[model samples]
Every structure is written in structure tokens, then in C-alpha cells.
Target: METLLSIIFIYIFVENFVLHRFFGICPFLGVSRKMETAIGMSMAVIFVMTMATLVTWLLYTFVLIPFNLGYLQIVTFILVIASLVQLVETVLRKISPTLYQGLGIFLPLITTNCAVLAVTLLAVRLEFAFIESIVFALAASVGFSLALIIMAGIRERLEMANMPDVLQGSAVTLITAGILSIAFLGFQGMLSL
Candidate 1:
């Protein structure tokens, strides 16, 4: 139980996929201009990442290892992740057209989101149990959502702020992301326990 809690804490505050590990920056920047879109993308990511972890773990354990197919992990993981992303895209388009449109290209780009792939691959490489893999994926996705939402909120505010041309747009966004990454570094000590 304590180990699980530690995993949760470390993933969320210390080794966040977006803010710390630096995965999934494409959607992190693209869909974060609005809180609504950011939240939507985050939800999709959480669902996809969790589902991908479940499927990939099962496949690796039950099929790949048994068949000496460990060499196919990357290709297998990509197929699983891509399939999950398609499911998310279809569902989101049906239930929330506005958000579907708001997400734009970034929605499809989730198929290539390194964070999702990283979670699945990491779970196998770390030799996590089924439950542990699920927990880790959930924690990582939640951390990603937290980072995206925070960035959206800050960007929304910055839209109205007076700024020099040099610091506008992507420049400021990158700088803000750097600062956020630095702030996340403060959580490093908590992991020592």
C-alpha cells in the first residue's frame, strides 16, 4: 500500500510525463491554449494511456513472452496505442463535437504522443504487475492533465497581458514551460522518502 502511494506521489509530483520527463510536448503545447480543449485532451490522454497500458501489458505477458516475441514490443505497443487513440477520437467526436473540433490536429497526434508510448513501454521494462502498470499509467496521465490545465490557465491569462513582441506566442510559452519544469523540480526531495 505504501509502495503504491509512493508510486503515485513520485509520478504525479516528481517524474511527471509532461512537466518533468518531457514527453508529449506536442499536445501539451498545441491543445493548451484553452482550458476546455486542454481538459478534453487530458481526458482523452488519460483514457488512452490507461487502456493502452492494460492491453500492452496483457499482450506482452500472455502472448509475446510465451511465444518468444519480445523483439516485437515496439511495433506491438505502437499498434495498441494507435488503436486506442482511434477509439478515443471516435468517441470524442461523437459525444463532444465542439471539443473534437477544438482539439484539431492535436487529437490525431495523440497517436504519436511519446508519453502514452512511454508509459506502456516503461510498465513492461519496469516489470510492473498488472495493477501496478495500471496505477502508474493513471498517475502519469493525471500528472499530464494537471500540467496541461495549469499551462492553459496561465496562457489564457497571458493572452491579455502586455508583453514585448519577442516574448509573445511560442517564445513565452516555451519560457513558461521551462519555469514550470523548474518548479516541478522542487518535488525531487519528496521522492527520497
Candidate 2:
């Protein structure tokens, strides 16, 4: 429907979790050094974000609110996110040792990624229906993946470009991220969602 399309567009381009809201900056910068690693991290993030959204939304709606235990929202959400990250870690370790190793600390760091937590909390706070929550989470994750891949590609190219010593390394990366953020900001008002 038009509403779903608006949700997807608004989250991906306008209110992007990474570029716009500035969540998950650690992995956004760390794993983005290589396209392969960025893709790996993005997949893990997408899985975790989507699953977390589903579980948390269900618990909040069916358990927490019904039981008048809404005060435990943050605690419950973190536990769900952390457990999901562990599942992802185990699966990645068994499936692709290279990516698992490449991700290193960043993979575990996804457990604490505010973006993951934010999506779940946002879905609940916005009172989104079950399907809307899934769509929102998927859109957010795709947006995050898009930003990560773009940053990785840019960083990879930047490694080859001749640049000043001052603007090299993290300096250039931060500058590039800022520029990308500004570009995403231009999407504002493009959609009313």
C-alpha cells in the first residue's frame, strides 16, 4: 500500500538510522573499511534489527502493557537484542569463519548498537501494528546497510586516492560521513511520512 511505501522511503532516505539519527557509528566506521566486511556486518545487523523488532513488539504488546510492566521496556528490549546478537554470532561463526573473524569486536558490538534498540523502541512508541513494525525494521536495516556499503566503497576508493597526511585515515572517514549525512538530510521534506 501507499502507507507501507511511505514508511520504507521515509526510514531509508529521510530518517535513516545511521546517516540521519547517527546510531551504530562504531560499526558504521569500523567494519566499513572493506566492502566484504561491511556487507557481512550489514547482514548481521539487518537480521538482528528485524528479529529484535518482532520479539520486542510482541512482548510489549502482549505481555508488558497487558501486565502493567511497561517500566521494564528498556531492560526487556536489551535482553532480547543481546540474545539475538548471540544467535547471530554463533551462526556466523559456524557458517563463515572469515567474516566472523573479520567482524571481530564489531560483531559483538552490534549487541549494544543503539540503532537496533531504537527500532524496537520506536515501533512500540509509535504503536505500529505487527506488520508495520516489521516493515519499519526492514526499511531501517536496509537503510543502515545502504549507508555502510556506500561508506565502505568510498573508503576503499579513498585508500587509493592521493591525499594529504592530515586528511587521511579517520579524518577522511569522518569527513566523508559528515558529507553523506548532509546529503541524506537533503531528503527531508521530500516525503511527508
For model 2, residues 21-116, the per-residue Cα lDDT tens digits are 888888888889999888878887887899899999999999999999999999999998998788878887899887678654566878878899
Per-candidate TM vs. native?
0.90, 0.90
lDDT of all the models against the reference?
Answer: 0.88, 0.89
lDDT score at residue 5, model 1, on the 0-100 scale: 84
Clashing pairs in 1: none
Candidate 1 lDDT tens digits, 25-144 = 988888889998888788878878899999999999999999999999999999988877777678878998876775544557788889999999999999989998999999999999
